[model samples]
Target: MMQFCYDDLDQWCHHCVHFVFVDEGLIAFSSFVLHLCAIKA
Candidate 1:
């Protein structure tokens, strides 16, 4: 039971990290697109 709990916690942590990484990538892409638009304008 303890091992199962630890595994669950590890999986949750991995998911959280993956989400944050994806979120950061999206924000960076958005900023890059805006920068391009500003330059075009």
Candidate 2:
């Protein structure tokens, strides 16, 4: 339903520097969601 999120999902997924280092997909997903909230606010 969210084209914005779908489009940016990959970049958002990879943007989490800490998550990248730790290889934590869950953290990256959370980080991506938080980033979207911040951006939309």
Candidate 3:
């Protein structure tokens, strides 16, 4: 797994949210629908 030190999770999370969803519709919905940043995290 990719280990993020110095509490860099915030930036990584933001970057990930965009990279995964691309700020599109429906992605902001439930994980059962989009599964974005909600994969058992």
The 0-to-1 C-alpha lDDT of every candidate, in the order given, reads 0.44, 0.54, 0.42
Q: Any runs in candidate 2 off by more than 4 Å, and if so which?
A: 1-25
Better of 1 and 2 by TM-score: 1
TM-scores for every candidate against the unseen true structure = 0.39, 0.38, 0.21
| Stronger candidate by lDDT (1 vs 3) | 1
The candidate with the higher lDDT, 2 or 3, is 2
Q: Where is model 3 poorest over a 10-residue stretch in terms of lDDT?
A: 28-37
Question: What is the per-residue lDDT of model 2 for residues 1-41, given as tens digits with 9 covering 90 to 100?
Answer: 33443466554444543443355656766775668657765
Q: What is candidate 1's TM-score against the reference?
A: 0.39
lDDT of 3 by residue, 1-41 (tens): 22441246454444434443554663654233334235536
- Number of clashes found in candidate 2: 0
Model 3 stretches with alpha carbons more than 4 Å out = 1-7, 22-41
Query: Which tens-of-lDDT digit does each residue in 1-41 have in candidate 1?
Result: 22442355343343322332356656665455445445655
Error of 3 at 16 (Å): 3.7
Model 3 residue 3 CA deviation (Å) reads 11
Off by over 4 Å in 1: 1-24
- For residue 36, give model 2's deviation from the true position in Å: 0.3
